[model samples]
Target: MKDFKVGHEIGKGKYGRVHLATNKSSGYIVALKILLKQELKHDKLLRQLEREVEIQGNLNHPNILKLYGYFQDEKRVVMILEWASLGTLYAQLKRQMRFVEKQASRYIAQIAKSLKYVHERHIVHRDLKPENLLIDKQGVLKLADFGWATYVQDFTKQVKLNISLKTNGYNTHNTHYSHFKYSSSLKTICGTLDYLAPEMVKRQSYNEKVDVWALGIICYELLVGVPPFESIGFPLTIQRIVLDEVMIPDYVSKEARDIIIMLLQKDPINRPSMEQVLNHPWIRMYNKSSPQNSTQTKLTKTIITNINYNNC
Candidate 1:
């Protein structure tokens, strides 16, 4: 603990708060996530915390937040994390309402790249939302919060793909309509309410495709200012997610709308992989200005280069 000096509190979470800190010798700025060990133990989340550290520590990517290291004492667990000066994407959304198609596409592309890297390693980031996304000083997006993440040793060894829309009810024991063998699939119902995939809502075993489903919801939220399936109540929200068709505004570009539709397919099998999402036409042309905005290129560049990281 003597190796770093802690400063002002920057954020808070379910079990802890994060503070700005600096390494004593290196003078490197970092975020100190201080978790109360007693609270973690009381909630029986010790293993979950360890898993988060293990999973995030091993991941290396420009678009993924870095977990530098951690230490613990009798009362607290302190994690050293890279400092994202610009705060969370959620905060940005609250301020800007919604992002332009070009900006949203670029952000989505960065997330897709990061997810592809994680998925390729057989890991599933079960919880992905704007709140879990941070922006660095360079205006780059970084995926954070891996507490619900898990590593699957054999994601490809799943034995079945039979999913029936007419199933009497959602039953993992019903092999006649099971999408994947329960033994080889993840069955834990997790993730944010609005971002839950259809399979997750059905209590069916799922895989990394759940993350892909979340990507679609996030993309829609970025462009439309709210989740596609969001409703007034919990039950209604779940129903909407399972049965409602997403309605993109006519103002959204065709390419952006097409990607969102492809990503939000009711069937997980029909949803494109992270790699496919990254390679989609919208992502490929994220830097191109829309026909309606002749000055968008300059405006975008200015927004990127002149970000007031400290204020954000």
Candidate 2:
């Protein structure tokens, strides 16, 4: 950790502060997220933190944040990461209130592509929201914060998959679902209330479809200028999400609106997969905005060449 000289705090997270730092040898700037080991141990979150570091380190995609590497001392867990100069998606949305159809779709499409990549590896990001998304200097969106993620392969299907999302949006509790059978896993009511699918609300066995619901909410917020379930309190908001009625503002393009509607479907199985989302008509609109796909992958990979990982 001494190799990187930490600087003034640039941001704060739930359990830590992010500093603008630089590597002494390479002179490369990075975002350093410092978490107190004591707090994590007290909260019984060491496993979650370890899991996050493990997951982020293994993932590599143009639309996913780069984890350069990490090491922990007795008191603190420090992560050196690629700095997202443009800040978080939440900040950008707050500044402009919303994005035009084309701009919004471009971000969504990129995220969808990344999610597809992860899902193919049996990982589920239980928490997905504007604040968890960051924008780079190139305006490319990348996902961050994997504390709520879980690898489905590690869990057993022999037990019923009735996972109940707890209040924090990070933990889940076990409950029974009488109507369901078979297995794929990822249940227990995870994710934010605004983004929870109806099946999750009912505490039924769920899968990656919950992420699609969250992505749809993001798409709606980008175009409609506000979260569909914003305002009111948590209780009322939860009820509205369960009802599954989201009004796509008239200004949203019909194709864009249709995708949002489909993504927000009350039935999880009915929602489009991330692969389907990438191919959606709304996403196709962004294809011409960027250059050929061949160069895109190579350029993005080159940008994070300093990052080293064991699993990926």
Candidate 3:
């Protein structure tokens, strides 16, 4: 704490609050996320916290929020993070109601590229939504909050090795086994209820494809203002996700609709990979380099100017 000067609260979360701070030496500004030790222990989230640090610490991608470092005192754990000057995508979405096709496509493409990077590393981001996406001053979208993310190994390769072990008559009990170190699909039912994929709704094991499913939902929400499966309550929403088909409005271009349909497939096997999502026609069309930055910066500044800075 001595290395910096903390300012007024900038954001709040379940764990604690985020404050705008500055490095005393370099004068670098950062967002300081302070998680309460007592609250973390009471919620039995110590292991989750450790995993969050481990997973997010190693991640390096332009579209992903940077976790500079972390320090702890007796009662608080403070994480130094990249400052997102434009606030969250959720707030912008709330104010604008919905985004145009071009804007939505550009944002989606960035998300796909970032997710592709993380998937290549065998990590899955269980929770993905506008609330967890931050926008920087330059209008760059960043993925944040890796508390529910975890590493997953290829099931086929591990299964083949396990079969070899059995054939050699080596007692499996003699070998050390840990799901955290090695796993095929993850079965834990975590993440927001609204964005739950079909397999997740059914309480079945799911892979990184779950993030692709969420990408579809986010795309839909970005263009339509609300999630496709949103219903009166949790049960109805679960039913919609499991049994109902997505109905993209006719106003949405065919290419945009096609990408959304491809992503929201009920079966995980049917959904496109993150690479495919990035290469989708709709994404590739508006994802052009030159126009994206200038347009995004203008739109972001316009929207941000309307937001009440005091609350943020």
Candidate 4:
């Protein structure tokens, strides 16, 4: 604690706040997530707090927020984290409204890679939203917030691929990283309802694909400046998620629209995994902007001024 000096508060939440902190000896900057132990104790969230700290501490990926280290004083727990110099994706979205499809494609593909890494390790990031995604100085996307995350072992016992669709297109389950789910038909609803999958809202057994469902919503929102199931009230939003079709705008490219449908499937079992999502055509668009293929480039003759003719 003595080695790090806290700066301005960067964010505040229900139980804690994020701050800019600098390491005194190395002069490295980091975001410190500080939680008052007393507050957690009073709320009886001690176990969840420990789990969050532990989860963040164990993750290691370039596109995942790095939890450098952590320690606890008598009063609080301090977490050292990667400082996203460009702030959050939510702030960026607010200013820009919606990103051009190309930019959004690049960003989401990076997130997919991060998801692939974590899912491979059986960690389910139950809470994934724009506010939890941070961008670094180089415009790289990183996933943050592990408060709602749980290991597949904690909830799932075995892989289940059976899912049934409604006569009018509704309830079902499919496999996307369906290798595991919470044991004993996992129970518990968490995270914001806006991005929650239908199965989650229906309180059915779910797995990592719920994260993919949220990814689909985020992809749509990134293109349209709003969520697919926009509503004026909470119940309305929940109703939409459970009953409404995922409608993509006409302006969206066909490739991007298809990926959204694949992701936001009514059945959790039908959604694509992060690995499959990244391989989809929409994500492939990220590599289409070649400098040689752009209007910005023009072929021109080059003359060498500094070269000696004798050397040639």
**Each prediction's TM-score versus the true structure:** 0.82, 0.83, 0.84, 0.82
Q: Judged by lDDT, which candidate is best?
A: 3
Q: Candidate 2, TM-score vs. the true structure?
A: 0.83
lDDT of 3 by residue, 238-294 (tens): 999999999999899999999999999999999998878877889889976622345
Cα deviation of 217, candidate 1, in Å: 0.6
Report the CA-based lDDT of candidate 3 relative to the real structure: 0.79
lDDT comparing candidate 4 with the true structure: 0.74
lDDT of 4 by residue, 231-288 (tens): 9998899999998998877999999889888988998878888778877988887845
- Pick the winner on TM-score between candidates 1 and 3: 3
Model 1: lDDT equals: 0.78
Task: Give per-residue lDDT, candidate 4, residue 44.
Answer: 35
TM-score of 3: 0.84
- Each prediction's RMSD over C-alphas, in Å, is 12.6, 8.0, 10.7, 15.4
**Whose TM-score is higher: candidate 3's or candidate 4's?**
3
Pairs with backbone N, CA or C atoms under 3 Å apart (clashes), candidate 1: none
Alpha-carbon deviation at 280 in model 4, angstroms: 0.5
Per-residue lDDT for 165-256 in model 1, tens only? 21233322233311221134788998899999999999998988899999999999999999998889999999999999999999899899
